[model samples]
Target chain A: MFQTISLFAPQLVLAFFASQLLSTGAFAKRDISIGVRNFSIFVLLIYSVIGFILGKPTGTAFKGALVIDDFSHYMNLIIGLSAAATLALSKSFFQIEKLDRFEFSILVLYCTLGMSIMVSANTLLALYIGIEMQSLALYIMAAFNRDSLRASEAGLKYFVLGALSSGLLLYGASLIYGFTGSIEFTQISEAISYGASPGIIAGMVFLLCGLAFKISAAPFHMWTPDVYEGAPTPVTAFFASVPKFAAMALIARLLVGPFETIVSQWQQVIVIFAILSMFIGAIGALVQVNIKRLMAYSSIANMGFALVALSAGNESGVKGMLIFMSIYVISIIGIFACILQMRIRDGMVENINDLAGLSKSNRSLALVLTVFMFSIMGIPPLLGFFGKFFAFVPAIEAGMVWLVVLALIASVIGAFYYLRLVKIIWGDESSHEFVEAPKTLRTIALMSSLLVFPILILPLISIPTQSLISRAASSLF
Target chain B: MLIAISFYSLAFVSVAAAFMVVASKNPVHSVLYLILTFFSAAGLFILMGAEFLALLIIMVYVGAVAVLFLFVVMMLDVDFVELKQGFLSYLPVGALVAIILLLEMLMVGAAYFAGETKTVVVRDNGVSNLEAFGQVLYTDYAGVFEAAGFVLLVAMIGAIVLTLRKREGVRKQIPSEQIARTKEKGLKMVDIKPGVGIE
Candidate 1:
């Protein structure tokens, strides 16, 4: 019992502090919203540090319900940092939108706790519970601005769809349990190693469908655009970055751990998801006017690329997925930080055209946005190119050359919108005079852009990231 | 023979009630049918020798959930006629989905029974069902049990955060302020003239 608790101490402590913060917010006489937000940020950073210090302790807790491995630790670190960065970026946006409730910070904390649990889940039950916990917090955060009808609609849509997906996931889990006679990943793998029944395959497909919805992969991505468009910008930023990594990590664990032997059965499903997501995400974003909606599609496409790596079903595949998502998360945070700074005297502008003449008005901000755009477009010498390169190489080696070629085509098509964004920011005439962004948001955006920019040095940042990710990925096998 | 008869009867009632739940036009009637369905399902569970699950179904679903549904259906003034307006247009797609689902379920059932898959059943340990459930839930599944608690906590917080709005010009009771009132503040002794109504 002690060992189990110790293994999960960071998440336990984070949840306790989150509850404490909730009560403090409820009881405090004066408005201490900023203090609470800052405290949550501090706690998140500390949680990440503690997880790093407790690096890769190989063990299982609660009788193999949760796994403590390098993959989980690395993913948790990324989740924690991105969540903190999200909270930090949210401060100014929350104040501007009159959404300075302290519950927001506490909810983000709990959401992070849930994601940490998700990446470490070793049982179907844990996966379902963790996803629910994360999603419940997210639904509330989506409608944090209760005064807006769109926000309420977004929350309702997300809740209804999320409930359906959870139902499908539970049904799949029950089917797997009935067929395999166990919920433990190891036992299930053992069961599959003998032979996979048709029932198990159906369950796997249903489970993947549900998991794909979480990552906003195509055919299950109906809710992403509306939710992204309607959710508050900071909340959308959090939605875009941290949860994607957690879900992807969970999927990778599921694939590499229990479903490794049944690769032939699931590989085609993943391939279809990848091809559909790439085409749909790339095409869907072309006509989108709202920057948030475009990002929604962009994320779908990015997950497609990650899926291509995952379809390889090997250590390199997981490595590439992690590295690609880490870089993607950073770039997304930078983009959202720039988006949050798009405030004018009237209100915040969300249209792509609204970025017109930003280069002349806010030269540095435009430059940061440009770097992020190019990075996401996977331009050579940028960090995103290396991410794509690593992700695609494993698939090519795995005899997925045709898929890579198609993905490249999709990405080429995807680049047009990104370039359009750049053109609007730098080329078009200044239409609206924007107010200055907060120093913290600007600094975060600048730092993220700098991280995405590959410094021409002997040891590039990707080298260290690759090494760490390879270690994490190898732990799964 | 008696157990089989009772099981069939209970199953029949439950299935009928479940169908009525979706087919009934009145929402209140639908909720009542839902409770009936729960009761019959509980009966079926009892027939299967799972008394603990049966009682749980009655206590949790029929007792609390059914009552809540009754209250909501009664209190909310939703227009059922307007809601059913699109039923005709949506019938084809709904029926197609229902048929596909039925076929898939049949296929799964066929596959399960025909294949070499064998369900591993736990041998009887001479303990009550509730005790056995508790043993695993608190011991083996403790992590998941605690995590489910967190899920509920998030749901509670979400409900309160989304709906609990503070409105101005509303009088509220402050127990601490009331308790802290001094005798002088609460019970001021006043001397009044005979005909002076405290103007």
Candidate 2:
């Protein structure tokens, strides 16, 4: 019982706070909303610090239904901090838009709780439950503004497709359980390490399909653009960052833990997904008008890059994937923050053309947006460049030079859209000017911009953080 | 032999009723067929000796789900024929999906039989079926059980938030106002001479 508590303390803490906030109807008043937001963020921050300190304890709970280790702890810290930042940035926006419902924060809390569970799950059953819990919250979050028809449509579409993929995932899990007589990752690893059967291979493929859909890789990325475009901008930012990290963490743990021995079979599959996602992301964004939809494609392409690192099937691969995911998430959050502040006269602007003459109006915000675009494009001496470099290095070392070359071409192609947005922001004249962003969003944007710049801060924290990430990565094997 | 015969009969009835559920023109009839299908499925579960699951199906699906479905079907003023107007036009596409699903199911079935497999469930020595189910669910899968509860809670909250509407003109009693009432505030004392021409 003590072991279970230790393993799940973060989720339990968030759950308790979430219920409290919900029961009190915190958002009905201004000060209560702020209080609930600050309290939850503080609690999450402290829990993440404790989780980080716990490190890789090699503790098992409930007969390996849950595991506490370096990888899970590291991901918990990343997810918790991102969630906290997201909530902080959303508070002012909610007040402005009259969307200050207490359910919004409570739902986000539950989603984060679900993500922490997902990262720690050791059994497929637990994993499925975690995923469902997270997706259910997300489905509601996507349609939190139920007054809008588009938001309702987005929610229904996401729920339907998400439920379908979950069904596929559960079916795959049942198949594996039937074949191996175990749902625990360690036991499955033991069984597969000896020899794999065709049934097991199919099961793994189905499972990968499910994870692929969750991460919005190509061929399963149908819902992303619509959902991103239709949901409230803050919810879109939350969707683009926290849940993606959790899903990527799950992919890493499953691939490196149980499916490691059968890399030869799944490697080709990952490579295929990587290649397709890259091409689709590049080609799909060229004609996009909405900035959010464009970012959706860029995210798909970036996930492909991370998958390339995972396909390397080594400790370095895992390390590189973590670095890549972290940078990409930060960049996405910053970009979405800027997008959220694109209000002109009264309504928010979502079209790329509406960004015309942004530099003339708000040069600082324009500069920050430029930095984010450059980082996403992986230009030299920027944070996103390092992310791609770290990921590609491991893949190259694994003799995936061909895949790396193709990914580079895709990066160049994908840069066109980002550059196009930059041109409109800086080079063109606009009829309307951007509204002043809330102080919290401005701070987040500044923080992300500083993190991505890489000149002053890179030397300060890179080596230590890199080594820590590597240590976490090595714990998987 | 008796168990096998009963199981086969139940399975056939369930499959036929399931087919009728989709084939019926009237939405209300479709719901009735769905209830029939659930009953037959529960019978099949009983034949398999999963008495707990059998009862659960009847209670949850037949008792709650089908009744709710019936209510919605009856309450809605939908034009059933109008809803089915596009069915013929979409038949070819639906057929294609059905064919693909059938082929995939066949593949999974083939794979299962081709491999050396063990039955997933083993009969325990001394425990009843309900007790065994309880032990496994509450012990081994306890985390999943709690997560299930979390999912349901989310669903409930979402349903309530989505369908709840605040109207423009409605009188609502403020609980705090009622609770905070004092005699001093509620009552007023008047100092006046009774029926005198003092004024």
Best by TM-score: 1
Q: Mind giving the per-residue lDDT tens digits that candidate 2 earns over A98-204? A: 87666777788888888988998899987888898899999999998898999999999999999889977987887778777789999999988877776677788
**DockQ per candidate, 2 decimals:** 0.73, 0.42
Which runs in model 2 stand beyond 4 Å of their true positions?
Answer: A1-4, A26-31, A54-56, A455-457, B13-33, B73-97, B166-169, B172-199
Residue A432 in candidate 2 has what lDDT? 91
RMSD of 1: 2.6
**Candidate 1 lDDT, A1-477, residue by residue in tens:** 665566887788788899899899989999899999999999999887676676546688878888988888788789889999999999998898788989899999999989988999999988998899999999999999988999999999998998998888888899889888989999999998988887888899889989998998989999999999999999999999999999999999999888999999999999999999999999999999999999999999999999999999999999989989998999999999999999999889999999999999989999999999999999988888988998899999999999999999999999999999999998999998789889999999998998898862128655676677888999999
**Residue B89 C-alpha lDDT in model 2:** 97
Clashes of each: 0, 0
What fraction of correct interface contacts does each candidate retain? 0.83, 0.48
User: What local lDDT does model 1 show for residue A86?
Assistant: 95
TM-score of 1: 0.94
